[model samples]
Target: MDCHPRGRGRGRGGRGNRNEESRDVRLSKSLSYALRHGANKMGLQMNSDGFVFVEELLAHQQFRSFSLEDVERVVATNDKQRFKLCNHPEDGRLQIRANQGHSVKVTDLELRAVALDDPDYPREAVHGSYMKHWPSIRSQGISRMNRTHIHLAPGLPGEGGVISGMRQSCDLAVYIDVAKAMSDGIQFFWSENGVLLTPGDAAGMLAPCYFSQAQRLKPSPCEIELH
Candidate 1:
């Protein structure tokens, strides 16, 4: 569930207080764990699209105590926009799912592609990684590992794409050639928030040759910064 923390506020004139931040962090972790990798064990039945009924989620042991309002707030306020709350078209019931970052074998979200005509469609993308993994990545390419798809970050003209694999220890960013990748028959899917998702090989993932550039960045050295 690509459930990374994004800065947010709790109310007018205030960022999230410690209590609110702690609560959200705990809830986000649990939700990501359950929905992305353990829905069946949790007794939450996800549809082919990875959506589970809101009622089912609320009834699940892990989240039975959380109100619908609480769930909605978490989904809406998530920085990465990882989870989505939607209305089930057929049943008209409220449903929710992790937008991407799934490891379980389920139907793909089959998200729509941003039209090339669209102003926000990205022509290039960025992926964050670490130097230590470069040898493997160069030789075998970026594999999905155990995850369902290879995630990519596509920032707007002046913005930076969200870098994965660079948190805490990663120190490199790889630039992607979106047009070239597409020309070679690689397909890319953009989530609701613009993160790119690729239907990678079931057994492996993208090959390193698809990446056009890799550069290292200095990691923060302060003890406080490391934490």
Candidate 2:
């Protein structure tokens, strides 16, 4: 559910063809791509809740060689808990969807709305980025870009309940003023996997005014000028 896709490890000691581990990684990435961003492009009939039939998905060219067990393995073994598998409400057919970080529109994906004073609200809401983009971010605030919502981590990586959302390689961290933003009509939602999501203001931008603090977190911790 991080902004940037995380890299997967290739299997070691493979002669020519990819090993089981390598194949699993490939299937995971493919599933992420299809479920998160390209279901429509891949010709999969995704519902408004962002779910597609597992059988239909497997029928796609990229997944033709894969079986149901392979998908179950990827979903079960994924460290980030990115995918969710369930049965269709109308019928009993199995379906799958991404937990969060969707670029394509998904109207109802089981996200819980968070209030500023609510206990479910994240104690720390941070957006991660790189130093190279700091200047632009300082001026323009945080843009959701092509994503439907801006992703935020509840806490830094390795902290409790901080499994995904922000990329580990990010050098800069922008802390958001959740109370202030909510008071001003900005909305926040919490995903099942503990990712904080915001649609931002009307223009889909979290303005600099709502940023409580900015800091360089990698190499060494250092404060950055927000004003």
Candidate 3:
């Protein structure tokens, strides 16, 4: 799905929240933290495909007070579509998993690569990041770092400005040469929200030269600037 991103952070476009909306935002972040980075500590075990039983997840002490309805509400309303719920292939039990951008280990999320020549492959892609990291990224290329894959957003080539769906922490947009990267053997995957993911190169990371251009963005005056 071409879902837009949502969060308590900036860049996510939303107005003042009602009590229910506030709770959903809070719950969504909590879910991301637990599933993508702290499943073990959250007392849940995800199978190789990065899936955990929804019932098991809700049973955790942190989530025990929340009902299945609450979980479903958050998933349904989440703008980013970060979490996905599906039926377990083996049984009929409901399961949940983070779509991509995982920092913690997940054995087999099954994110395979798409060819550069694929019709839907974006001509240009953008990576959101802080300006502080630009120098290193320019020299070494984008890395997944602790995450499972490098997260990217699709944009049109020759687009002169920042595209949508950037993270609040980002002040810079790095444009990627998707076709060139793929031709150079870098593989790309699509997340549930249409975010692009790549496994990088043989060294397990993207090289600096693959980044075609970058630009720093100014925040809107209405944005609540955070230090």
Alpha carbon lDDT of each predicted model: 0.68, 0.85, 0.71
Model 1, residue 146: what's the lDDT?
A: 71
Evaluated with TM-score, which candidate comes out highest?
2
lDDT of 3 by residue, 22-124 (tens): 7667778888888898998777897877888889988888777666776776766665667877776667687778888688767677665677557777867
- Predicted candidate 3: what Cα RMSD to the true structure? 7.1
Native-to-model Cα distance after best TM-score fit, residue 120 in candidate 3, in Å: 2.1
**How many pairs in model 2 have backbone atoms within 3 A of each other, for residues 3 or more apart or on separate chains, i.e. clashes?**
0
Model 2 spans with C-alpha error above 4 angstroms: 1-18
| Model 2 Cα shift for residue 78 (angstroms) | 1.3
Arranged by lDDT with the best first, the candidates are 2, 3, 1
Cα displacement (angstroms), candidate 3, residue 191, comes to 1.5
Per-residue C-alpha lDDT of model 2 across residues 1-227, encoded as one tens digit per residue: 21222223323333244577788889989998999999989899999989989999999999998878777777876878888888776686888899998899999898999987797676558999999999999999999999899999877777886988888899999999888889999999988788899999999999998888899997998999997
Which residue pairs clash within candidate 1? 141-208
For model 3, what is the error of residue 8's alpha carbon versus the real structure, in angstroms, after optimal superposition?
20
lDDT winner, 1 or 3: 3
In candidate 1, stretches whose alpha carbon ends up further than 4 angstroms from where it belongs are 1-15, 114-121, 156-170, 201-203, 220-227
Q: What TM-score would candidate 3 get against the native?
A: 0.79
User: What's the lDDT for residue 113 in model 3?
Assistant: 63
Could you tell which candidate, 2 or 3, scores higher by TM-score?
2
